[model samples]
Target chain A: MRTEAIDPPGISWHRVSPKYVTVRLVQWAIENLITVVVLTLPLVFVLLGWWRWPPLWLAITVPAVTLVLAVWRLLLIPRQVRAIGYAERDDDLLVRGGIFFQRTMTVPYGRMQYVDIGVGPVERGLGLCTLKLHTASPGTNASIPGLPAAEGARLREQLAARGEARLAGL
Target chain B: MTANVPEAGAPSAVPVAPDGEWLRVHPASPFVRGWVALAAIGFFFGRDFFERLLQGRPVFEQDFAGRAPWLVAGGGIVLVVTVLGFILTWYFTKYQISEGYVRVNSGFLFRQQRQARLDRVQAIDIVQPLLARIFGLAELKFEVADAGESAVKLAYLRMDVARQLRATILARAAGMVPDPARPQEAAPEAPEHPVLSVPPSRLIGSLLLSEQSFFVVVGGIASVILSAVTENRGFFFYLIPAVLGLAASYWGSFNKGYNFTAAISPDGIRLRYGLLDTQAQTLPPGRVQALKVAQSPLWRIFGWYRIQVNVAGYGAAGSNGETASRTTLLPVGKLPEVMSMLALVLPDPGTPEPGRIFAAGLSGLDSDGGFVTTPLRARFLAPLGWRRNGFATTDSALLIRSGRWWRELVVVPHQRTQSMALHQGPLARRFRVADLVLHTTAGPVSPRLTQAGLDEARSLFDAQSARARLARKRQISEQWLATVVPAPVVAPVVTPVVVPTQTPLPQQSPQQEGPQRG
Candidate 1:
């Protein structure tokens, strides 16, 4: 495989930090764990004889099935990380990522509603921060999962300045 | 400002002006206010019941022990809550005018910050509920485009302030200054169209003669009787006051309906109704996306029609904000006037053009467009009411179609269309006919003009979709052209530079020399 490097001047770039990626993964795990526990509560009750128990073999089968599903997701995490990438064009920030299907989304600095930068405990431990770009559309939320704290702050400042300039028609 | 104004016959001539005079909105309570009122009432009533219970009083005791103490405590609590409510209502509510927006900030705990851009605001509706009317207060409602879920409500504002804000917002939205030249003109005055006002007697007669109200009274009576029979024998005692209250309310509503008048103005439409809590909503025409003129079976007897519009940012029914329905252009239910009002509020569907075509070939006289096609292979598939389904379209994109046998009439304009859909059921597949529906951004005005012929409908659908897309593209392109400046062209001048000429002339071939000379 061969790769060529292109130097583009006056173009800005942003990257997600490792710490931010770790924080998001932890949050995702916590949320999925809650869902899993809620879904399995009935089976747990059945096994304890508090409710009607399924056949002994079926009872064993259900947990095994759930474990397989959980393990499948755990194995897909690396693929998910590899999918996430960012590129800055002349006028917009492009974030591209999807596990099974690849998608690239562009948010023009002029149209950005706001930028939020925050660091979770996990991200803080890893010395990384997350940057979220919000638009008027409530559902279409975009985020750069991880970036170094210093880089995140610098990107926030640059985005805010660009947004101000656009608003002022400068 | 003068410099920004376009010269005569200029292509882009719309003038952009500075922000208009600022107006202050009325201070109103948040949704939490109603919850607080309910909580206070519940607490007072609950505390009394609990006090009686603690004294070992029977649940059904007519004369309970410790009643006086409980009553005193309840009264004191009510008084305190009322005082607190009054202070909070006065102090915590405030709205203001920012550069190009109306900012409303309210609430004690969960703060709500709502802002509506002056330019985006389509209309201002003022609603006065029964309680607010007594205090000469009104709620100001703003209808804005692209406002999403934030419907602005200014609660308990002075009526004058609401009107002032409405005028200011309208002026700013229409891209004008608050011209001092129009000082004599009242801000909320209705237009003096010949059909604007219905005679007071006729209005009263219509309300009294309405069978709908009669049925409502009958329904209320039936419900009261049913409840009395099912709940308890002792409930009979309460029936007297309840019946009297019902009668009084019926009379009040009737009287309210009597003096009603609807009018269309150049700026917007105004409706005035109600006996106790009178309401006036000024709905600007440009804000209206869709207009619906409806008549019930009973209303048909009296040649009456009720008109409603689909507007954004107006509070929904039973919402915390000012009731938007009150701003209805015509509540008097006069058919001709309703039609004229609709024309004034909605965009023109354009004059009917010749060479108009029907997509659904032909079905029957009763079919929307008058034709139905059945292929030889698909004879088993036929619409149950083929006679009542079809669609027609004009070159300019006005579409009309009808179905449902009992209720019909759907018309739409192509410019407003957002999507086109085709559906096929198993039965439809057997007949080689499918349903084509065209959807628009406007609510209710979106017409599902089901053209019956599958192939023809698909072709027409493709054409209409392409037309709508082209119209949108043209609009965007026009805006872009107006804003973007083209780079100036520089003519290349061949200046005689001895060294440059010597180098270039030596390298040029015969073709190159000819082109350079030309």
Candidate 2:
């Protein structure tokens, strides 16, 4: 029961779909693994005697640096994913995220220009999507990642309806 | 309502009762563009001929006399192609004024249709390019609120028709019916009453008086003299482009600011200026989120100041190369004029002691005003403007006065503030001070207040956040005022007391009472 209480209280904070974790992890692995392979290619070639370097440290240093980065990113992925949450208020929507450099953005409903729902192949497989809210000021555009496909569509429809109504009022 | 109209095709093919009479620009628009293109081509040819002559070549005899027929044929083809392009462009571009939107369709090969909502129009500008002015034609520019990256522009209409269209659009945008019979009569005066004007002589004087122009002219002359004395032809030739570039920019600035005038209008503040090419811009009320009153260092010698505003749609409009939409309210003015312009833009200034606040923000001479000045530690960082770098707050706005040589006073309304944060670097942390930044939509306004004490910064953050939230909550949908007030309801004789359903607006928190002056 205690472990289930993952979200912040009172604000009704909504976490992204749990399937997003697997999608993100797979994406992270693919991206880092590609970089690691590309970076370690010369080292592999050198070790196999296909290529030669005068400095000789090239074989050791490149893979070592790539390995360090791969490990760091692998460690930070879950924390970064967990840090993201969003809440819908009466007049505004709030998005909070970031593991070290924290940010909380409040986007007033009246100022919303449009709402965009985007889905990628992985996200579609996981039944998740992302929502982007745009405003007149470029700095204030807020994006929420990893909502369930059904929830994302519902949110998009509601946000669009609310935007139109508020804009008409203006 | 025209659901049957296909998305892609010539609009003329499926005319569904002609949606409120589509208006095409002046017939001479293509001629204007053709003339401009021809002039450019002539300039290049003339330059080539002159360069050959300067090189001591028998250019006229060899190039023109020998190949006169070929030259004539080539010139004719070029002119024909240019005119063809202009005609195609003008033919494809047309605008339709529907009930709720003004739709402009343009482009020859790739069709582009932009529709600006009638209610969302912030302002309309009438612009005349050098060539267009000669032909008595103008372009209509619409500054539509919240339409990011896309603005509707209908170019090259007769000047009178442009004014009439602007009047019609503005009136419609403000939810007023345009009188059919008097459409052309008072429409010109609706946004064109001259409130102030800068004389041509004064404009020329200001241009020459600026230190940049003086230095450029002097430097060019000095270099020419030096090269002549040294008999260095190469050096002299090299300096020609640089000197000419400076002269051209100075001339451009002069032309852009010539005959500058400001006017009061029902829609907003109207401005008209230019020598060869004229521009008339209306900055609607409530569209201006922030303002900057600035005086460059040299302008201080003549006590001249300039004011600029962060009007919503002005900056984001795609550039038209006129330099008219620079968002300047006052390019050069005396203290009295600047003060009047200030009042015109930010009428409230959100304070009772407006004079004191304005004086402090402009001059920063008085220490007793409500402005919170930076501590002495700032002297090391800014050196010149540190003492005057301060901020003052009102119930609905924030005023920051900064700069020493090039002074600036920025006024940001609370509701317009997008976000705010306190930023402290390592040195700032050591000095126990931080910079407060208030984010705004892109424009000329500086978004930062610097070097406040830690405690003061924290208090300011808290107070500003609360005030901004409150202001946003109470924001009204309309920007204009009605002259009449509704009569108060009279309770029936049978009912002893009338019960009110809605509560009155909430009072400000006691802790957030009016701040005392420093």
Best by lDDT: 2
Where's the lowest-lDDT run of ten residues in candidate 2 chain B?
A: B509-518
**How many angstroms is residue B187 displaced in model 1 relative to the true structure, after the best TM-score fit?**
8.2
* Model 2 Cα lDDT, one tens digit per residue, A1-170: 11111112356667777677787888888888888888888887887888877245977787788889888988887777776777786666766666544444566666677888899999988889999987766556478888998999998888877766544222
Tens digit per residue, CA lDDT, model 2, B255-297: 8898899987777788888888888888766667778888777
True contacts kept of each: 0.00, 0.08
- The TM-scores of chain A alone, one per candidate, are 0.73, 0.86
Q: List the residue pairs that clash in candidate 2.
A: none
lDDT of 1 at B167: 66
* Candidate-wise lDDT, in order: 0.52, 0.69
Best-fitting candidate, scored by DockQ:
2
The clash numbers for all candidates, in the given order, read 9, 0
TM-score of each: 0.51, 0.71
